[model samples]
Target chain A: GAGVSQSPSNKVTEKGKDVELRCDPISGHTALYWYRQRLGQGLEFLIYFQGNSAPDKSGLPSDRFSAERTGESVSTLTIQRTQQEDSAVYLCASSFGTGGTYEQYFGPGTRLTVT
Target chain B: SQQGEEDPQALSIQEGENATMNCSYKTSINNLQWYRQNSGRGLVHLILIRSNEREKHSGRLRVTLDTSKKSSSLLITASRAADTASYFCATRSISGGSNYKLTFGKGTLLTVNP
Candidate 1:
């Protein structure tokens, strides 16, 4: 649509349950990113997808955190076997390029709470 | 790990006063960008300064970069209550393996009193 959009806006799950956060990036944008922000903290890079290049999975904090983006459109970040530490605002952003002066457009973000 | 660190941690100023926040990074960067967040939700892109450039302005916001010192500063002139939010500086590193990643700082919480 006009800008990056994220689903749910808020998610509350059990400590052991799994949660999936979705992001629909602005059309034609070749790069998308997932980040997490704890209360009073900064954005932490979770994963990045750029064009057809191999998705940068290096930022994933653990094996339980995974993301999938089909081509350049929608992306889903799944947190399996969630813990209290997973509670945070999950943000999604889209950009023309991660480099070369492209500024990221962010979504409203999904505030995930694991109880 | 976060590459940039914002100073002052938190800042409070009356409306119409100027608010300045500083950020320092550990490595070289291709560009430095400032973003604003309200109520802890989405972030709005403020301004960006490239490595080759030193300063940039967007409306009431101004940013300066010093590649030699690996530092940058954001200035919000004649601030308003609506301008009260968390400001962050994100850097696109120049490293070969991680040039695409934008590392962010903890942010400076700005509170503009009315």
Candidate 2:
């Protein structure tokens, strides 16, 4: 079976443009998460979607960042009016929701460069 | 806020030698997990230890958790050159409910020279 997959391995865009990054979680996974990693820094949590529960938006840095998952499969992280500070590698991860282990599988990630 | 903090930002060692990295975190957690990254791309999940677990072993990887001290350690035995990468410790906070959102540390970059 395939591991998590993210589209547009690399994306370059000018400031103020909107960009949508896609993620395809492994089949049967019901939990998905998004995180951002700046150069030489740790990963920062962005948002989480588990089954049909309301997405956890606590980690979203600002209103410009948002994410949506249809059912328990594909997810998209959208950045509205991106800023130069938004430049970083956006990583997606998925795992078994309930009654499963804690390990998570990750996607290759989308390196977004906001110039 | 960052929870887990890995000690010794970087390390270098010869192949076949053992390597050890430690992490200290704040607050109670449901579990601790280790991840490896190559070229700063997708992270590979190495191991996971629940809060109640004291130690675990997976192949050459060993992980120990000390809830009393709020710390954890990752030891890699007989390392290989291919093991050179950044290792990060992450914690799933008890306060995170079902979200299980992990708070990661800055990570320890290990260079294994063949």
Candidate 3:
């Protein structure tokens, strides 16, 4: 019974560079989501994936933010042309299904610092 | 724009004391969930109360949802120092088209002094 896990606990990159954050959801989870949290701020929804259907990219701030999930397992969030405003903690979460009644389990997150 | 807003922003209490946090949302929701975050790490799901339920309890945690008022409250009794953390309320809108998106509030910082 493993929980959600994210890679590169911390990442430091230069402006204009691209960074990819990885997330490994719990086994058997069919839904995954990505969110961003700025310092002392609330979480901002980024994207969501349910099974193999079309991913919800409505929350993506810009065209630079993209995410892909292979089947129902891992997901990778990529941010292109990073800016100072992009510096924040990228959190990943997953649940048994795609709606209410299921609680989403979160990952430790990857702190990205754009210098 | 966040769907939910937590009141009091911060709270400080002595160990064994009870703590209460309130959250107010603007839109209709199918359910409301409370989560605890230690420092800035990952969030831990504390409780989930459906819109139809007025009150629910889990150990020392009690959650109440009032759909008529579009608000909810989380009460933690006999709090310990380890209970100090940021509490957030997330709302799952009634619209099912959004899929798994849960709008979160800014959260309340709770400090339990032992």
On DockQ, the candidate that comes out on top is: 1
Structure candidate 1, residue pairs in collision: none
**Candidate 2 vs candidate 3, DockQ winner:** 3
- How does each model score on TM-score? 0.97, 0.96, 0.98
Poorly placed runs, candidate 2 (over 4 Å): A98-100, B96-99
Provide backbone clash counts, one per model.
0, 0, 0
Better of 1 and 2 by DockQ: 1
Global fold similarity of model 3 (TM-score) = 0.98
By lDDT rank, best first, the candidates go: 3, 1, 2
Residue B27 miss distance in model 2 (angstroms): 0.6
List the pairs of residues colliding in candidate 2: none
- What local distance difference test score does each model get? 0.93, 0.92, 0.94
lDDT of 2 at B81: 97
Q: Categorize the docking of model 3.
A: medium
Question: Which digits, one per residue and each the tens of the lDDT, describe model 1 over residues B1-114?
Answer: 999999989999999999999999998898999999999999999888899999999999889999889999999999999999999999998888888788999999999999
Q: Which 10 consecutive residues of model 2 chain B have the lowest summed lDDT?
A: B92-101
Tens digits of per-residue lDDT, candidate 2, B44-74, equal: 9999999899999999999999999999999
